[model samples]
Target: MKKLTSRIDKEKLLLAVAAPLLALVAALVVTALVILATGKNPFPAFNDMLSYGSASDSQVYILNKATTYYLAGIAVAIGFRMNLFNIGVDGQYRLAAFLAAVVGGALSLPGIVQIPVIILVAMLVGAVWSAIAGILKVTRGVSEVISTIMLNAIATAIIAYLLQPERLGQLDEAGTLVSTKPLPESSWFFTLDMGPAGQLWGFIVVAVVVGVAYWFTLGRTRFGFDLRAVGQSESAAAASGANVKKMIVTSMIISGAVAGLVGMPTLLNDSHQFDNSFPLGLGFTGIAIALLGRNHPVGVALAALLWGYLERTTGHFEVIGYDKEILGVIQGVIVLCVVIAYELVRRYGLKRQQQRVGAELAAQAAKTDTEVTA
Candidate 1:
């Protein structure tokens, strides 16, 4: 019986690691097939990407990109852990970052105070944006997915209005670009010198801090347990005295607040202000990374790094006349494959666990039978 339990535990551990890995391998193979159909030699493209992504300068790019992605993934994962899909992360971050940029840019506070003030504003706005959908879901019986999608559209419109030169922004000397006032030097996130290639964004610290906080919040707190319980089953959680509606609203707000930070790495470090060209769609990428990582913080980090590496490799492909769209295809395939693989592995683990328990019971019964016969 003891041996059977040990075996089952080891098998479960193996399955957890093996499932995603096999899925990744399958995704690569499928991507190769797609490239062949396009009449391109996939190997050379793959080689180029791998080589470029491994370069020192490219590593900094990957790190910066991955930092942003990490925050986004955590934002989505917060929703995922609660079985809530907060798709408006894109809108939430965009609006929050813009507002924060405007506020921070206007402020004349010291470096320490200015940075936190900007972050606070972003979080508040992001939470408010997401809370709109959460409120509708809890109060009006609206689906979060639907509400958040609508909110995203609304957020985009609002951002467009706010971004006009006569509104929260001003036209640059070229009159071709619209951006918020540049942030004060005190408020800008300083970069670290990388000796040669360039300076690494200081917001890497922010990413690490957020990641640690996320893990701590989800793993070490009563609220985390309650969130997971609600996710597992609302009916069960309610029976145990958990407030279902409260959890949903709170989860969405938390998700949104984190989503607010998704743009900070770029905003504070590189752009130093919000602009029309500020990145959009990072929220969607976060969802993919969250799914790819199975919503674990560590897994999410790895997935973000992989995704960033792939993205940074695209410049090489574009330079070499290969279509950059192939990377997108691979990313989509990998995400789909990871989900399927996890489900399959979960079922296999369940079956094996049941078999292990049955085998142990049988052995115990046989021993009893021998004792009675003796």
Candidate 2:
């Protein structure tokens, strides 16, 4: 029994690894074909990307980018685990960052006091915004997908209205752009001076902490078990005495709270304000990363790094006379491949399990018949 169990575990691990590998290979092939159709040698571009992306400066950039991506991925994964499609992550993070920046800019306090306050405000705002969708889903039978998408539009409009010179925003002396007031120098997050390699954002440490917390909460706690049970089958969970409606709302709030952190790396370490230049569409990217990672913490981290790598390397293509649009093609292909590969692997695993169970039952029956004959 022990040997059989060990074998099964090993097989499962192999299957898990195989899915990503298969997806990557398929993506590469498709990308190569697309490049060929464009009358370019894809191998040279691939080699150049590998070389450029491995440079020390590039590594720093990738880490900073991955920090944001990791946070976004975690926020989306939280929703994915609960069988929830939280398309509002973009709005949630943007609103959180905007409000947090406004509050931080208005306050002058010790770093220890002000930073936490800003973060808390962001989380609270994000939770409230997402909870609206959750409450509607549970009470009014509205689809979260529809509500979250609509909320995104509303959030955009609100930001546009509030980000005026007469409102919470400020215009620079040049008058070309409007943004929230810049955070004080004292409130600036720490960084590691890597000399020519550039500065590494301290927010990477925060991302690591978030990942650890996510793993512990989801894998080791009773609440995690209930959440997973409800995700699998809400009716079954309710039959088992779980509060289905409450779980849905709580999960959304938690997901949004994390989503609030997605902009911190940029706001604190680089931009220091919420502005027109703040990244958009990151919530959509997070969905891809979450799917690629299968919603596991370590896997999500790796997927985030991969995303950063692709973005970092692909920009160099334009400088080398290659079309920058290749990035979109590659990313889209990879996501599609990942989806297909995982589904195939899942079906294969299910078939293997069924076979194993049938064989075990047959052997048990044969042994019983032999014993009766004896």
lDDT of each: 0.90, 0.94
**Residue ranges of candidate 2 with Cα displaced over 4 Å:** none
lDDT of 1: 0.90
Per-residue C-alpha lDDT of model 2 across residues 148-234, encoded as one tens digit per residue: 999999999999999999999999989999999999988888999999999999999999999999999999998998899999999
Work out how many backbone clashes candidate 1 has: 0
- On residues 1-374, what C-alpha lDDT tens digit does candidate 1 reach at each position? 67887898899889999998989899989999998998889899888887888789999989899999999999999999999998889999999999999998788999999999999899999999999998899999999999988888998898889888888898889999999988998888889999776788989898898889889988999898899999999999999999999999999999999999998888888998888889989999999999988889999999999998988887667679787788789889999899899999999899889987988899899999999999
| C-alpha lDDT (0 to 100) for residue 113 of candidate 1 | 92
Clash count list over all predictions: 0, 0
Q: TM-score for every candidate vs. truth?
A: 0.97, 0.98
RMSD of each: 1.2, 1.0
The number of clashing residue pairs in model 2 is: 0
| Model 1 TM-score, all chains together | 0.97
Name the candidate that leads on TM-score.
2
Q: Which pairs in model 2 have colliding backbones?
A: none
